[model samples]
Target: MSGNRSQVIIQSKRPPLSSAAPVKVTTPSSVNYHFTRQCNYKCGFCFHTAITSFVLPIEEAKRGLRLLKEAGMKKINFSGGEPFLQQKGAFLGELVQYCKQELQLPSVSIVSNGSMIKEAWFQKYGEFVDILAISCDSFDEQTNQTIGRAQRGKSHVENLYKIQSWCKKYRVAFKINSVINTFNVHEDMTENITGLNPVRWKVFQCLLIEGENTGENSLREAEKFVITDQEFQDFLDRHQSIKCLVPESNQKMRFLDCRAGRKDPSKSILDVGVQEAIKFSGFDEKMFFKRGGKYVWSKADMKLSW
Candidate 1:
């Protein structure tokens, strides 16, 4: 296995297809590959802030993705500190292109903050990505800033609209991931959420990992973002009018068989292989699919022109 390193390249063209064939997995329906935990935002409630570094080399990442593809993994969502934080989004685009064109993975998607994305990236690699899940915690600017999701000089809410428009133009399924924290738990986002018209709205109860987002090693102990279950429910009740709402409570998120809740030290498939890596993380297929992980909009399920 190659050493983990960062490669910052502006991709004028896609990388050549690796002759190495894909290794398939038959058990899991989908996998959330937190490929890079290097994020631009310092949101206090972030669960995956355990690592602040990008470790896997591009070749290693591609190999691991191919392995997952061969493993019969139907869908894969690339998450990060921020997936689009790389140069010209070239690093992320290369991986997406490989999944769609080489491995031929049915669904290849990204979870981003929507602050750093550009129209040029969508125009170039839009066809490769099936969905773009953006994180927007609140419709209120002050509330967003207080939650540490505020972009300098740029409006996060405004960026949401811009990205939504780009998604419509590029034919990528748009989704919103909002963590209902104490900061914005009561902020009524119904008007803004409804107007945006996301294909899915994933609302998460603010979560805390033992040492990742809490304890000594964390970037910022996220006690401030913590909200009670009743508070979370109240927030949900306020937005019940939204068309596509998917709620995941903290109990369901942390205690139940949830795929995205586990905060074990993430390892590359190069080190542990795909199965052991997933098994080590406790990814539950039932919970994953139950949360609409294998939706039709994913995996090349384009409703618009590619």
Candidate 2:
């Protein structure tokens, strides 16, 4: 989509696609464990099939926390249909607070659809999160409504600007996340978002996951927004500070990986770590570090990092 005459997107040349194929190897992931499903937005990008609504039981999460620490994972992120939906929105604030104060995890992040966000939630628990990735596909209200974010007030641009104000006030990491497809491909991306927030924008290539209510159809509409792998690398280079990582799989896609080298044949670094943390909520933070193993990013292409 060409932007209004002389827009940066129109003037900017897109990069080419890379030859890298999705490889299959299991290595310890540096950004380790994620919380169970629990989100509010019926996001087109979620693999949960528009269903993020549940925190892992306390017993389960405690063990999961321990395993994550042992693996030497640098960051722990919380994502769900809407992670804030734990205990029906009321507990959202408490969940985040506990994650930071009690778990004491070094780095924690949350990806929200932002349709159900409340002002008070941010003012109170803003510090609990290290990064807040908000899903904002376009500036057009009609376009956003088509993609299932009807709850947002007025227009996408308005809500985004207001949300940015909150982020700035809290001094929290505020990233603008989007899965570009046809509907939003034409909007003024670099202009609309970059004008206000610099180096915090993230553009994601839409994944073709089946089963989700608005996945394939949305992707089809946003097809023009589809940039090949090389184009993505170029986009990141052009917008150097945005901190983008385009997985070959695109989203939390499931693929066959048998080389994780778990000590127990059935155990995976992700599985063992999350499971161990959930085992003992009573365990001390120090003990979790000792028992939870290092998270190994065992990729089909690269050897173990830790």
Please write out the lDDT profile of model 1 over residues 128-179, one tens digit for every residue: 9988999999888888898889777879999999999999888888899999
* Backbone clashes, candidate 1: 10
On residues 11-81, what C-alpha lDDT tens digit does candidate 2 reach at each position? 01112335673532221233323344444455444444323223455555545445544444345555555
By TM-score, how accurate is candidate 2? Answer: 0.60
Once fitted onto the true fold, the runs of candidate 2 whose alpha carbons sit more than 4 angstroms away are 1-29, 32-40, 50-54, 88-92, 152-154, 210-306
Model 2 scores worst on lDDT over the 10 consecutive residues at 1-10
